[model samples]
Target: MGKVTGFLEHQRVKETYQPAEARLRHYQEFVSTLPVLDARTQAARCMDCGIPFCNNGCPVNNIIPDFNDLVYRDDWKSAIDVLHSTNNFPEFTGRICPAPCEAACTLNFNNEPVGIKSIERSIIDRAWEEGWVVPQPPAVNTGRRVAVIGSGPAGLAAAQQLARAGHDVTVFEKNDRVGGLLRYGIPDFKLEKTSIDRRVRQMEQEGVTFRTGVLVGDWPVGSRVGNLSTETVSPERLRTEFDAVLLAGGAEQPRDLPVPGRELDGVHFAMEFLPQQNRVNAGDRLERQIHAAGKHVIVIGGGDTGSDCMGTSHRHGAASVTQFELLPQPPEQEHKPLSWPYWPQKLRTSSSHEEGGAREFAIGTKEFIGENGRVTGIRTVRLAWEGGRMTEVEGSEQVLPADLVLLAMGFVSPVGSVLEAFGVARDPRGNAQASTEEEGGYVTNVPGVFAAGDMRRGQSLVVWAIREGRQAARAVDEFLMGQSALPR
Candidate 1:
């Protein structure tokens, strides 16, 4: 512990967000990392608890306390090393992750938790500025080639690790651009594209090759999943060439609302609306786009995707925006006694929520109302929950006016085209069936084929994706060389 009484002496400080009015004018990151002095002060607040739960709380198991102590002692170089030992991309997690680690901090049992995310962001930023981040190519090539599908965080992490372990690595991206979901699914307002580009550059120097505009298997025709492939590669080709193949593609099949007027012109999936703006921001000239400008927008499913829709609608100068959630609202404050050192269900207000929007809870969309082959409004009903079962409240049905509707419900599973092409078995939830056991883990039914990230475990966080990617790299390395020194 840097300061034994630090928790009692200091207060938790958060990263600063640009004013909502100014931030809404453009599609760029609005949050500013904490200053070095404030970051050190925040780091001093880590407790000398017997066990550090923040490590287990994080999906990648980041060394939270060690880095916290390093930042407090002004040893930034050591902090970055500790951070990179476990996590490959601190920048991504620092900017977008919900930071479950903070929720599990010992100080959070009573006092505000240390600003671990902000400190993490500061450490990496300083490392990049000082040019400490560099490529570490393998000393000797093993002549073993590994093919990675998808250029998202998981694929990138696995590719980088395999390259460092002396395997010839190549990543195939279906879209015209790399970064997968980070390039298209997430908006630039939360994370600028340059953040991903620099990391890609570093990975390239580490001997990992990226081939964009290439699809590995068939994509469902007219599917809402983003696709900009200029070429398609058969699964047989990869098996014949590469020693191992890792499926790291995302779970992109967005959950749909199959109501009466679902086919209306103005209704669309959240992926359909979010990706266009990202492409436009990247300077691509789209012939047509799903714009929210000058329209009344209704976003169904009150999760992160719904919040993103609301934010983008604000940027588009929509007339009004409303969000709906089927479940009841969670309490603003969590009960520490019951949820200590664990992720608790509570209301989380994002930066977009601060900009503007109406949030409706315990409400379900019954039908889509439209005229002239376009959406005009939505029919909704309030509900009550008893004994964990929901019952619709009588006489509480109403219509909410809208010009556009976006289904922002979470993803159900990975798009199955690639799995089908490779003849891989799927779990009950439609994700690739692969265990996480110590032996023969991350391997599919097909020899030399492995699965990880959302493709294997279904939709999850970026940190989880990185963890799976790293572990899968180790699994592939062992399969290729009979053993590996890479961390699992």
Candidate 2:
């Protein structure tokens, strides 16, 4: 700890955001990082508990206390070193991660936790500015080649670790650009593309090859999700050429509402709507897009993707925006006593929620009403929950006007075709079948094939994806070399 009584002396500080009105006008990042002094004060609030549940709370298992203390002492170089020891991409997590580490802080037992996410962002930002972030190319090439199937955080993290461990690594992204969902799925306002591009440059310098617009296996035909691949490489070719193959592709199959009007013209998946704007922002002109401008938009499923749809709609000057959640609203405040050292369910109001949109809870859409084959309204009903069972409230059906409807429900699994192409086993939940605790962790039933990240764990946070990637790299390194210096 920087001060003997720093936690008692300072209150938790949050990063300031640009006004909703101002931020809604553009798609650039709006949240400002804390100044150095304020960030130090925030770091001082870390109790550096004896157990440090924050380490386990974070998916990457970052050395939280050490970095916090370093930041408090103004030793940013050491802070970045501590941060990089476990995490390959703090900037990605610092911006978008929900910060489970903060929730697990012992301070949350009675008071606000340390601003770990903001302090983390500060450290990485300063490191990038001071040129501390550089390619760590392996001193000697082990001459083992590994092929990573996705360019998301998981694949990127694994590729970096494998490269550093002297393996020749190549990442295949089906999309036209690197960074997979990070470059396409996430809105630019929350994370700029430059954040990902800079890392790609570094990874290239580290001797990792990136093949964009290239698919490693057959993509599902007629699929609307992530269908930008122009070239295909059979898994057989990859297996024959590479020493090991890692499946780090994300779960891209968005869940659907199989209701009466799901096939209506205006009804679309959130993945369909969100990526178009991201492409437009990247200077790619789409002749036609799922435009929300001057239209009544109803986003079903209250999650990050839904919030992203709402924010994009706002930027598109939609006439109105509304979001729906099937479950009843969570409590406004978390009961820290029972939930201490673990994540608690509570209402989270994102910056997009503050951008002027109505939210409906405990409601389910029954059908989409349309006119001339275009969605004109939606039929919805309120729900009543008891004893973990859900029932529709009687006489609760109502019609709400909508020109565009986005299904923001979560993903169910990775594309089945990709897994089938490689003959990798899938779990009961449709994710790739693999074990993390057993020997040869991350290995699939098929030899030389491994799975990690969302492809193995289903939908998850970026931090979790990175963790899976790093751990999977260790497993692959071990399999290849009979021993691995890579940390799990």
Candidate 3:
């Protein structure tokens, strides 16, 4: 610990952000960094908890207390080294992760966590500014070849780890550019593409080869990854060319609302809308862009993806924006005493919601009302939960004007064709079947084939994806070389 009584002497402070009105005008990151002195002061707030629940709370098991002490002691370089010892990308997690570690902080018993996420962001940002971040290429080659499919966090993480382990790693992405969802799914204001570009460059320096615009399955794909490519590489080729193959493809099947008027022109998936804006922000020419200008928009789903759509719509100057959630609204604050260590269920009003958008909960969309093949409005009904089931309330049906409707209900599973193409069995939930046990974890049904990340575990957070990828890389290395040094 930096100081025995530091926690008692300091109070928690977080990073600041630009005014909502100003930030909504452009798709650039607006969060300002905490000053060095203030960051050290905040770092001092970390209590010397004997158990350190933050480690268990974090999916990547970041060394929270050690790094906090390092920051408090002004050991900036060592602090970042400690941060990267576990997490492959602190910048990505710092900006986007919900920071479950903070929730698990012992100080959270009183509802004021140690501000772990902010501290993390400060350390990594400082490292980059000071040029402490650099690539570490392996000294010797293992002569083993590995192919990682998907190019998302999981795939990227696995490829980087394997390459560092002295294996030849190649990542295949269906998109035209690298970074997978980091490149296209997330909006620019939250995490700029530069962060991803920097990491990709570092990975390349570490000897990982990235191949974009290469689909790993059949033609006429229905998902976004499929739409990015004109041709697909058969699984047979992958199996023959690479010593081991890891399927890190994300869950691309979007959950759809198959109500009437689903085929209307103005109705689109959140994926369809989110990626176009990202491409435009990257200076790509979109002949026909999806915009919410002068139109009333309704986004069905209240998750991060939905909020992203809300933010993007505001940037497009939508006439009005409304978001609906089928589940009832959670409490404004979590019951902290009862949920100190677990992820709490509470009202999470994102920055996008603050920008300008009406949000409704416990409402079910009934039908899409359209005119001349375009969506015009949405009919909905109020719902109540009873006996753990949601039932619509009588005499509570309503209609809202909507020019564009986005379905952000989350993903169902990976595309079946890709899984089938590899002849890999899937779990009951339709994900690639892979265990996490020492004996068979991450190994798929087919020999020399593995799976990880959202493709194997279903939709999850970026931190979890990184963990899966790192672990999967170890598994692949072990399979190919009969031994491995990569961390699990």
Candidate 4:
């Protein structure tokens, strides 16, 4: 809108990255933000499309066109204002979000879309550098006390919103640090913990209390693998003390590969392996921390988590890295006509994939080969789909060397104990049962109890989690005060 023919004049400019070899030496953010003029040019590329699909494409419904125009007009302050108006944390999404908004951009019908993600990163980074980002404490106290379970993006967003509504908000986290997966599960190469710390400080100034390393329910039994809770607080205590409780614990129960030799050592869940390295990077000393140094590593599941593992393994000086996907490899590109205005299925090669690794698709693992109680390799078989059934290809069985096997098959559900303690119902897919309706939305079966984010909707993007948290804050506010002014 700032320039009538800006899209035609400028091609999309992407952020530059540090050489993979140089970045692999340490765990730090490697992607460089766009220059100011470049960001402005990208923002200028936002055409005056009558219908702004980018807004709806974004899970948080960010005012994309407004921010783009503001940035293009050299009004960085207003750009950040419009940005923070919707997204509680743009830095996280700007760095990691797949940018479905760009996919839905009208210009993307034929030409390259506006570099929205790069511009977003530039605006927020500038805001922080210029001291434009600061605490916005509420004007008055509402005298309501709210408890938010978990300190991931979802919980943090809800806490900030609820606190701004003049409520006494407290967040509970099972990890030693405030951020849940952001501080542990994710590699520092994408998002540094310092970014999370800055927001945590702002939230504290806004009257939000954080209780870390405290489990809000019974400790998950039988699996000490991923449990980070050191202290326990009974669900009854929270129910009796707080006016309302919001369950925002993320889906943490990782799906497992239960083939033969799964019990062997060195075959670990992605959660277990990832958190260990993250802790190490944070300067925590752990004896026998998992490492990929000089070992043939096989990462199962070709998702973001698997990519993260691949990157981490590369940092660990892995001998060789290989990834596996059960499904057939997707096409290199999508047909725009059929998939316009929505996320498309195509071959996605992450920065980690670009670093170095072998990717095997349409292959299934038959068994794990081990020696002396340790995994040594994996037996695989090629597959073909016929009539909705997978048929093994004859004479296609093979064994691959694997000193370490990381299962990054995504999470199945939240730790059941926490939900069971609150007596929250679960959906067929095992996510916390709740709705997003305006009336009694996010409310669980139990009175004064609500759920949001990954807990309520299952594992999803950080943007979606932030959206759920903000909306659920409004729902909780309405439940306690009978009405709320917070945005959905």
Q: Could you tally the backbone clashes for each prediction?
A: 0, 0, 1, 0
Residue pairs clashing in model 2 are none
Candidate 4 residue pairs that clash: none
Q: List the residue pairs that clash in candidate 1.
A: none
Write model 4 residue lDDT over 109-177, tens digit each, in one string.
888888889999999999999999999999999999999999999999999999999999999987788
| Candidate 4: segments with Cα more than 4 A from true spot | 219-229
* Model 4: how far residue 96 lies from native, Å: 1.0
Tell me which of candidates 3 and 4 scores higher on lDDT. Answer: 4
Candidate 2 lDDT over 262-334, as tens digits, reads 8889999999999899999999888788899999999999999999999999999999999999999999998
Looking at model 3, how many pairs of residues clash?
1
Count backbone overlaps in model 1: 0
Candidate 3 — what's its lDDT?
0.91
Worst 10 residues of 4 by lDDT: 220-229
> Which residue pairs clash within candidate 3?
435-441
CA lDDT for candidate 1 = 0.92
What would the TM-scores of all predictions be?
0.98, 0.98, 0.97, 0.98
lDDT values for all models = 0.92, 0.93, 0.91, 0.92
Q: Candidate 3: RMSD over Cα atoms?
A: 1.6
